[model samples]
Target: MRYPEQYLQFIEKFNEGEYYECHDLLEEIWMEDKSDKFLQGLLQLAVGLYHRECGNIKGARWMFGNARKYLARYAPSRWGLDIDQIILYIQSCEQALPDADSIPYAKAKAMAFPSLRLLIDQS
Candidate 1:
């Protein structure tokens, strides 16, 4: 199945550091159709980013890990994940933290993607 333009916009939001917006936008698509694995993975990724932005490092890590695992079943080109970029971000995030509590929301926000607003509007 093709990932929609709106969904792509949602991802761009994630790439731009708009975690809450990313979560909200992707929820629309997930609401419409829950069975699409790609969409589900994307939604999970957005939600994970939201948690990270909100200072829920454990939750964010779990969600991101899950998203990565699920998206891995599909190709980056096919699923719209920039695998290399995500891996780098994840590595950075991981390397900075001793534990979840040590991760500041502001720091996470700085590390987050900046296109979350674009995704919300696209939906």
Candidate 2:
């Protein structure tokens, strides 16, 4: 499926660990269609990662949960993304910081973050 350039940019930034930039890049496209759950899910995912990286455990957990809810309907696949994998990743992230309120910044910072890649078709 053909995707918007901003979506591609979001993926690139996401892979590069530039979560905040990913959120910024995709927010415009998402705003154009508020009902686009896929876009909203992606945006929330990016924001969740950004919050995680910034050591805001509560916010990160909240965003991650919301992202899952928004993305679940499209499970298995959507717009080249393995939604299942993304959901699993989010779950793993949540697991790493189980007690959001009690987790220390150093612990959160020490957690290994995973990168996500889109399944682009070269054909």
Candidate 3:
């Protein structure tokens, strides 16, 4: 399936660790169709990463949890992306952080962030 330009931009921003920009790019498309689970999943993933970057552990956890729920149906691939791999990365992020009201900024900053790659079509 052909991907939207904004979605392509989202992927670029996402891989570059510009999570906020990723959100901005994807939210435009997502707003047009709230029922689009795939878009919701990608948007949530971006927001989750943004929250993590900002040291909002609770928010990050919340977004990550919801992202997984939305994206789960799309696994293990969709629109040239590895949905399963993305989900696994989210799982790892959730696992790495402690279940607490808040975590230190340094802790959050020290955590390794995840990046995604689109699967190139050879056909």
Candidate 4:
């Protein structure tokens, strides 16, 4: 499935710290492109962030694990996304899991999820 020319809306929601909205925005693309591992990784990451922010430790852990595995095969940059940066962001969340398990978004420094941006074509 071909994606739209831009994913700026996703980035907007993400940067706004609207993790749940990010999940919804990306899921639309993911449903159409089930074969895209990158999309899966992204979706998992978004859900993981959402769960983390919402204080759902169980869901956060599951989604992060999936994202780590799925995103491992790709480079740091692809599909206008900084895959490595995202993976590192997820890893940071993993490290803070114990601290975040009982706390909410306001209290967890690791729950601060980064916004994703589509890369601009140089051409």
Q: For model 4, how does the per-residue alpha-carbon lDDT over 1-123 read when each residue is reduced to its tens digit?
A: 333633567766767767677777877777887987876887787788778777788788899999888987776666556777777877877776764345665655454444454443333
lDDT by residue (36-55, candidate 1, tens digit) is 66666666767876776677
Error of 3 at 88 (Å): 1.1
TM-score of 4: 0.75
Compared with the true structure, model 1 gives a TM-score of 0.64
Pairs that clash in candidate 1? 13-115, 13-116, 15-113, 15-114, 16-113, 16-114, 16-115, 17-112, 17-113, 17-114
lDDT of 4 at 28: 77
For all predictions, the C-alpha RMSD in Å is 5.4, 1.9, 1.8, 3.6
Which portions of model 2 miss their true places by more than 4 Å?
A: 102-107, 121-123
User: Ten-residue segment with the worst summed lDDT in candidate 1?
Assistant: 114-123
Instruction: Report the C-alpha lDDT of model 3 over 5-115, residue by residue, as the tens digit.
Output: 998888787777888888889888889999999999889988988888778889989999999999999988888888888899889888866677576788878877655
C-alpha displacement of 121 in model 1, angstroms?
22
How high is each candidate's TM-score?
0.64, 0.88, 0.88, 0.75
